[model samples]
Target: MSLSPLPLGGAAPSATRTPSRSAALALVFGAFVLAGCATEPPPPPAPAIPQYTSPIPASALVGRYGLAAYHRPQDATRTETQARAQCSNPYVITDGPNGGVMMYLADDTKLTEVISKQVPGQPTYIGPAEDPAGGERDRQVISFNGTVLQLKWVDPEIAKRYGIMVYVRCP
Candidate 1:
Protein backbone atom coordinates (compact mmCIF):
# COMPACT_ATOMS: atom_id res chain seq x y z
CA MET A 1 0.00 0.00 0.00
CA SER A 2 1.13 3.59 -0.73
CA LEU A 3 1.65 6.10 2.12
CA SER A 4 -0.69 9.19 2.29
CA PRO A 5 -0.12 12.75 3.60
CA LEU A 6 -1.36 13.39 7.25
CA PRO A 7 -4.39 15.71 7.97
CA LEU A 8 -3.99 18.94 10.09
CA GLY A 9 -5.73 17.29 13.18
CA GLY A 10 -4.12 14.19 14.83
CA ALA A 11 -7.27 12.03 14.21
CA ALA A 12 -6.96 9.26 11.62
CA PRO A 13 -9.30 9.10 8.62
CA SER A 14 -11.60 6.04 8.61
CA ALA A 15 -14.52 4.78 6.48
CA THR A 16 -16.88 4.58 9.52
CA ARG A 17 -16.50 6.72 12.75
CA THR A 18 -17.34 5.14 16.11
CA PRO A 19 -19.86 7.38 18.05
CA SER A 20 -18.10 6.89 21.43
CA ARG A 21 -19.61 9.87 23.27
CA SER A 22 -23.22 9.25 22.17
CA ALA A 23 -23.01 5.49 22.92
CA ALA A 24 -21.59 6.16 26.41
CA LEU A 25 -24.21 8.87 27.06
CA ALA A 26 -26.99 6.52 25.99
CA LEU A 27 -25.65 3.79 28.29
CA VAL A 28 -25.36 6.16 31.26
CA PHE A 29 -28.89 7.55 30.65
CA GLY A 30 -30.31 4.00 30.44
CA ALA A 31 -28.59 3.06 33.69
CA PHE A 32 -30.06 6.12 35.46
CA VAL A 33 -33.58 5.43 34.18
CA LEU A 34 -33.37 1.74 35.20
CA ALA A 35 -31.98 2.68 38.59
CA GLY A 36 -34.82 5.13 39.19
CA CYS A 37 -37.43 2.54 38.22
CA ALA A 38 -35.81 -0.29 40.26
CA THR A 39 -35.46 1.54 43.55
CA GLU A 40 -36.26 -0.59 46.65
CA PRO A 41 -39.44 0.08 48.62
CA PRO A 42 -39.44 1.29 52.22
CA PRO A 43 -39.81 -1.41 54.88
CA PRO A 44 -43.09 -1.95 56.78
CA PRO A 45 -43.66 -0.59 60.27
CA ALA A 46 -43.00 -2.81 63.31
CA PRO A 47 -45.85 -4.22 65.39
CA ALA A 48 -46.84 -2.33 68.53
CA ILE A 49 -47.39 -3.91 71.95
CA PRO A 50 -49.63 -2.11 74.44
CA GLN A 51 -48.56 -1.36 78.02
CA TYR A 52 -50.74 -1.28 81.12
CA THR A 53 -50.40 -0.80 84.89
CA SER A 54 -52.12 -2.83 87.58
CA PRO A 55 -53.33 -1.48 90.93
CA ILE A 56 -53.33 -5.00 92.42
CA PRO A 57 -50.04 -6.89 92.28
CA ALA A 58 -49.81 -10.60 91.52
CA SER A 59 -47.98 -11.40 94.80
CA ALA A 60 -51.10 -10.57 96.81
CA LEU A 61 -53.04 -13.44 95.15
CA VAL A 62 -50.36 -16.13 95.02
CA GLY A 63 -51.30 -18.87 97.44
CA ARG A 64 -53.33 -22.06 97.94
CA TYR A 65 -57.10 -21.65 97.60
CA GLY A 66 -60.19 -23.80 97.34
CA LEU A 67 -61.90 -23.24 93.97
CA ALA A 68 -65.55 -23.46 93.06
CA ALA A 69 -67.53 -22.64 89.89
CA TYR A 70 -71.04 -21.23 90.07
CA HIS A 71 -73.51 -20.25 87.33
CA ARG A 72 -75.44 -17.30 88.76
CA PRO A 73 -74.14 -14.10 90.36
CA GLN A 74 -76.24 -14.73 93.49
CA ASP A 75 -74.72 -18.21 93.78
CA ALA A 76 -71.23 -16.77 94.23
CA THR A 77 -71.83 -16.31 97.97
CA ARG A 78 -72.98 -19.89 98.27
CA THR A 79 -70.00 -21.15 96.23
CA GLU A 80 -67.56 -19.44 98.59
CA THR A 81 -68.51 -21.92 101.34
CA GLN A 82 -68.14 -24.83 98.92
CA ALA A 83 -64.74 -23.58 97.86
CA ARG A 84 -63.64 -23.38 101.49
CA ALA A 85 -64.58 -27.04 101.93
CA GLN A 86 -62.35 -27.97 98.98
CA CYS A 87 -59.09 -27.20 100.82
CA SER A 88 -58.17 -30.91 100.70
CA ASN A 89 -57.81 -30.51 96.90
CA PRO A 90 -56.79 -26.90 96.61
CA TYR A 91 -56.10 -24.90 93.47
CA VAL A 92 -52.69 -23.35 93.86
CA ILE A 93 -51.50 -20.03 92.44
CA THR A 94 -47.77 -19.48 92.30
CA ASP A 95 -45.30 -16.86 91.15
CA GLY A 96 -44.49 -17.01 87.47
CA PRO A 97 -41.05 -17.21 85.85
CA ASN A 98 -41.41 -13.58 84.93
CA GLY A 99 -42.67 -10.83 87.27
CA GLY A 100 -46.24 -12.09 86.95
CA VAL A 101 -48.43 -14.90 88.27
CA MET A 102 -48.90 -18.49 87.16
CA MET A 103 -52.51 -19.49 86.64
CA TYR A 104 -54.60 -21.76 84.44
CA LEU A 105 -56.48 -20.39 81.42
CA ALA A 106 -60.06 -21.37 80.71
CA ASP A 107 -60.41 -25.10 79.95
CA ASP A 108 -56.62 -25.47 80.08
CA THR A 109 -55.05 -27.75 82.62
CA LYS A 110 -51.51 -26.47 82.04
CA LEU A 111 -50.46 -23.43 83.99
CA THR A 112 -49.57 -20.25 82.08
CA GLU A 113 -47.95 -16.94 82.96
CA VAL A 114 -50.53 -14.21 83.43
CA ILE A 115 -50.31 -10.47 83.93
CA SER A 116 -52.71 -8.43 86.00
CA LYS A 117 -54.02 -5.28 84.31
CA GLN A 118 -56.41 -2.53 85.33
CA VAL A 119 -58.09 -0.54 82.58
CA PRO A 120 -60.01 2.66 83.19
CA GLY A 121 -63.73 2.13 83.95
CA GLN A 122 -63.13 -1.65 83.87
CA PRO A 123 -62.57 -4.28 86.47
CA THR A 124 -59.10 -5.75 87.10
CA TYR A 125 -58.19 -8.69 84.86
CA ILE A 126 -55.53 -11.36 84.61
CA GLY A 127 -54.61 -12.89 81.27
CA PRO A 128 -51.81 -14.33 79.10
CA ALA A 129 -48.66 -12.38 78.29
CA GLU A 130 -48.98 -9.57 75.73
CA ASP A 131 -52.78 -9.81 75.79
CA PRO A 132 -54.94 -6.77 76.47
CA ALA A 133 -56.87 -6.50 79.72
CA GLY A 134 -60.29 -8.22 79.56
CA GLY A 135 -59.24 -10.16 76.46
CA GLU A 136 -61.26 -13.17 75.38
CA ARG A 137 -59.23 -15.54 77.52
CA ASP A 138 -58.91 -13.12 80.43
CA ARG A 139 -60.65 -13.46 83.76
CA GLN A 140 -62.31 -10.44 85.34
CA VAL A 141 -61.81 -10.03 89.07
CA ILE A 142 -65.39 -9.57 90.26
CA SER A 143 -64.29 -9.28 93.86
CA PHE A 144 -61.23 -10.06 96.01
CA ASN A 145 -61.39 -9.36 99.71
CA GLY A 146 -58.21 -11.18 100.88
CA THR A 147 -60.28 -14.19 101.88
CA VAL A 148 -62.36 -14.83 98.75
CA LEU A 149 -61.75 -13.97 95.09
CA GLN A 150 -64.48 -14.11 92.45
CA LEU A 151 -63.48 -14.33 88.76
CA LYS A 152 -65.54 -14.47 85.59
CA TRP A 153 -64.23 -15.37 82.16
CA VAL A 154 -64.46 -12.70 79.46
CA ASP A 155 -65.65 -15.03 76.71
CA PRO A 156 -69.39 -15.61 76.88
CA GLU A 157 -69.19 -19.30 75.97
CA ILE A 158 -66.40 -19.94 78.43
CA ALA A 159 -68.29 -17.92 81.04
CA LYS A 160 -71.37 -20.05 80.51
CA ARG A 161 -69.39 -23.28 80.71
CA TYR A 162 -67.05 -22.40 83.57
CA GLY A 163 -69.33 -19.86 85.32
CA ILE A 164 -68.15 -17.50 88.04
CA MET A 165 -65.00 -18.79 89.75
CA VAL A 166 -64.77 -18.44 93.51
CA TYR A 167 -61.41 -18.93 95.23
CA VAL A 168 -61.53 -19.20 99.00
CA ARG A 169 -58.17 -18.81 100.69
CA CYS A 170 -57.32 -21.80 102.88
CA PRO A 171 -55.99 -21.44 106.41
Candidate 2:
Protein backbone atom coordinates (compact mmCIF):
# COMPACT_ATOMS: atom_id res chain seq x y z
CA MET A 1 0.00 0.00 0.00
CA SER A 2 1.30 3.57 -0.85
CA LEU A 3 1.01 6.41 1.87
CA SER A 4 -0.25 9.98 1.00
CA PRO A 5 0.42 13.31 2.87
CA LEU A 6 -2.55 14.73 4.98
CA PRO A 7 -4.09 18.17 4.06
CA LEU A 8 -3.12 21.22 6.18
CA GLY A 9 -5.70 22.82 8.67
CA GLY A 10 -7.75 19.60 8.50
CA ALA A 11 -8.46 17.52 11.66
CA ALA A 12 -6.81 14.12 11.78
CA PRO A 13 -9.15 11.30 11.06
CA SER A 14 -10.48 9.86 14.31
CA ALA A 15 -13.52 7.95 15.67
CA THR A 16 -14.75 11.08 17.63
CA ARG A 17 -15.88 14.25 15.76
CA THR A 18 -14.19 17.59 16.66
CA PRO A 19 -16.44 20.63 17.07
CA SER A 20 -15.92 23.63 14.70
CA ARG A 21 -15.02 27.16 16.03
CA SER A 22 -18.55 28.45 15.23
CA ALA A 23 -20.16 25.54 17.12
CA ALA A 24 -17.95 26.06 20.21
CA LEU A 25 -18.64 29.86 20.17
CA ALA A 26 -22.41 29.15 19.85
CA LEU A 27 -22.33 26.91 22.91
CA VAL A 28 -20.53 29.61 24.92
CA PHE A 29 -23.06 32.26 23.76
CA GLY A 30 -25.99 30.02 24.75
CA ALA A 31 -24.51 29.62 28.23
CA PHE A 32 -24.20 33.42 28.56
CA VAL A 33 -27.87 33.87 27.49
CA LEU A 34 -29.05 31.34 30.11
CA ALA A 35 -26.91 32.97 32.80
CA GLY A 36 -28.34 36.43 31.98
CA CYS A 37 -31.90 35.08 32.34
CA ALA A 38 -31.13 33.51 35.78
CA THR A 39 -31.42 36.87 37.54
CA GLU A 40 -34.95 38.17 38.46
CA PRO A 41 -36.65 40.84 36.34
CA PRO A 42 -36.84 44.42 37.60
CA PRO A 43 -39.74 45.21 39.97
CA PRO A 44 -42.89 46.88 38.65
CA PRO A 45 -43.25 50.65 38.84
CA ALA A 46 -45.22 52.16 41.75
CA PRO A 47 -48.84 53.23 41.17
CA ALA A 48 -49.69 56.94 40.83
CA ILE A 49 -51.37 58.37 43.92
CA PRO A 50 -54.31 60.77 43.60
CA GLN A 51 -54.68 64.05 45.49
CA TYR A 52 -56.90 63.68 48.59
CA THR A 53 -58.39 66.90 50.00
CA SER A 54 -61.92 66.89 51.39
CA PRO A 55 -64.44 69.67 50.74
CA ILE A 56 -65.75 69.06 54.24
CA PRO A 57 -62.96 69.93 56.63
CA ALA A 58 -62.11 67.57 59.51
CA SER A 59 -62.60 70.34 62.07
CA ALA A 60 -66.27 70.60 61.09
CA LEU A 61 -66.90 66.95 62.11
CA VAL A 62 -65.12 67.08 65.48
CA GLY A 63 -67.43 66.69 68.47
CA ARG A 64 -69.29 64.16 70.62
CA TYR A 65 -71.95 62.42 68.52
CA GLY A 66 -74.82 60.17 69.47
CA LEU A 67 -74.13 57.16 67.23
CA ALA A 68 -76.57 54.61 65.79
CA ALA A 69 -76.39 51.88 63.14
CA TYR A 70 -79.15 50.81 60.74
CA HIS A 71 -79.26 48.69 57.58
CA ARG A 72 -81.93 50.20 55.29
CA PRO A 73 -81.92 53.65 53.74
CA GLN A 74 -85.56 54.03 54.76
CA ASP A 75 -84.46 53.48 58.38
CA ALA A 76 -81.99 56.39 58.23
CA THR A 77 -84.51 59.01 59.38
CA ARG A 78 -85.58 56.86 62.28
CA THR A 79 -81.97 56.00 63.07
CA GLU A 80 -81.23 59.69 63.52
CA THR A 81 -83.73 59.82 66.39
CA GLN A 82 -82.10 56.73 67.96
CA ALA A 83 -78.70 58.28 67.51
CA ARG A 84 -79.83 61.47 69.21
CA ALA A 85 -81.08 59.42 72.18
CA GLN A 86 -77.72 57.70 72.50
CA CYS A 87 -76.15 61.03 73.47
CA SER A 88 -75.81 59.63 76.98
CA ASN A 89 -73.02 57.34 75.66
CA PRO A 90 -71.77 59.18 72.61
CA TYR A 91 -68.99 58.45 70.15
CA VAL A 92 -66.28 61.03 70.55
CA ILE A 93 -64.31 62.41 67.60
CA THR A 94 -61.17 64.24 68.62
CA ASP A 95 -58.61 66.21 66.63
CA GLY A 96 -55.69 64.12 65.38
CA PRO A 97 -52.01 65.09 65.65
CA ASN A 98 -52.28 66.33 62.10
CA GLY A 99 -55.37 67.93 60.57
CA GLY A 100 -57.25 64.61 60.43
CA VAL A 101 -59.68 63.23 63.01
CA MET A 102 -59.13 60.37 65.46
CA MET A 103 -61.78 57.64 65.40
CA TYR A 104 -62.17 53.88 65.52
CA LEU A 105 -61.91 51.80 62.37
CA ALA A 106 -64.38 49.00 61.57
CA ASP A 107 -64.02 46.06 64.00
CA ASP A 108 -61.11 47.86 65.67
CA THR A 109 -61.08 49.01 69.28
CA LYS A 110 -58.06 51.32 69.08
CA LEU A 111 -58.68 54.73 67.58
CA THR A 112 -56.90 55.48 64.30
CA GLU A 113 -56.21 58.77 62.56
CA VAL A 114 -58.81 59.10 59.79
CA ILE A 115 -58.44 61.41 56.85
CA SER A 116 -61.43 62.96 55.07
CA LYS A 117 -60.72 62.72 51.34
CA GLN A 118 -62.84 63.77 48.36
CA VAL A 119 -62.09 62.89 44.77
CA PRO A 120 -63.60 64.86 41.90
CA GLY A 121 -67.23 63.80 41.24
CA GLN A 122 -67.03 61.23 44.05
CA PRO A 123 -68.54 61.03 47.50
CA THR A 124 -66.23 62.02 50.38
CA TYR A 125 -64.44 59.19 52.17
CA ILE A 126 -62.95 58.73 55.66
CA GLY A 127 -60.14 56.25 56.34
CA PRO A 128 -56.52 55.92 57.41
CA ALA A 129 -53.94 57.81 55.32
CA GLU A 130 -52.45 54.54 54.00
CA ASP A 131 -55.70 53.68 52.14
CA PRO A 132 -57.03 55.40 49.04
CA ALA A 133 -60.34 57.23 48.97
CA GLY A 134 -63.23 54.71 48.81
CA GLY A 135 -60.76 51.92 49.61
CA GLU A 136 -61.57 48.84 51.74
CA ARG A 137 -60.91 50.58 55.06
CA ASP A 138 -62.66 53.77 53.93
CA ARG A 139 -66.24 54.83 54.56
CA GLN A 140 -68.28 56.93 52.13
CA VAL A 141 -69.98 59.96 53.59
CA ILE A 142 -73.68 59.27 52.95
CA SER A 143 -74.86 62.64 54.23
CA PHE A 144 -73.74 65.46 56.49
CA ASN A 145 -75.74 68.40 57.68
CA GLY A 146 -74.76 70.73 60.59
CA THR A 147 -76.15 68.25 63.16
CA VAL A 148 -76.26 64.88 61.42
CA LEU A 149 -73.55 62.90 59.60
CA GLN A 150 -74.10 59.52 57.98
CA LEU A 151 -71.38 57.11 56.77
CA LYS A 152 -71.41 53.77 54.97
CA TRP A 153 -68.47 51.39 54.90
CA VAL A 154 -66.92 50.81 51.46
CA ASP A 155 -66.50 47.10 52.12
CA PRO A 156 -69.86 45.34 51.70
CA GLU A 157 -69.09 42.72 54.35
CA ILE A 158 -68.07 45.40 56.83
CA ALA A 159 -71.11 47.51 55.88
CA LYS A 160 -73.32 44.48 56.54
CA ARG A 161 -71.73 43.93 59.92
CA TYR A 162 -71.47 47.58 60.97
CA GLY A 163 -74.55 48.90 59.12
CA ILE A 164 -75.01 52.54 58.06
CA MET A 165 -73.49 54.75 60.74
CA VAL A 166 -75.64 57.70 61.85
CA TYR A 167 -74.04 60.35 64.00
CA VAL A 168 -76.25 63.01 65.56
CA ARG A 169 -74.27 65.85 67.08
CA CYS A 170 -74.94 66.09 70.78
CA PRO A 171 -76.15 69.42 72.19
User: Number of the top candidate by TM-score?
Assistant: 2
lDDT of 1 at 4: 85
lDDT of 2 by residue, 1-171 (tens): 976665445556668877878899999999999999998889998876567877778899899999999998898889999999999999999999988899999889999999889878888999987678889999999888878989999999999999999999999
Total clashing residue pairs per candidate? 0, 0
Residue range with the least summed lDDT across 10 consecutive positions in model 1: 5-14
TM-score of each: 0.73, 0.74
lDDT of 1 by residue, 54-106 (tens): 76688888999999999977887788899999999999999999878999998
Q: List the residue pairs that clash in candidate 2.
A: none
Candidate 1: Cα lDDT at 133: 84
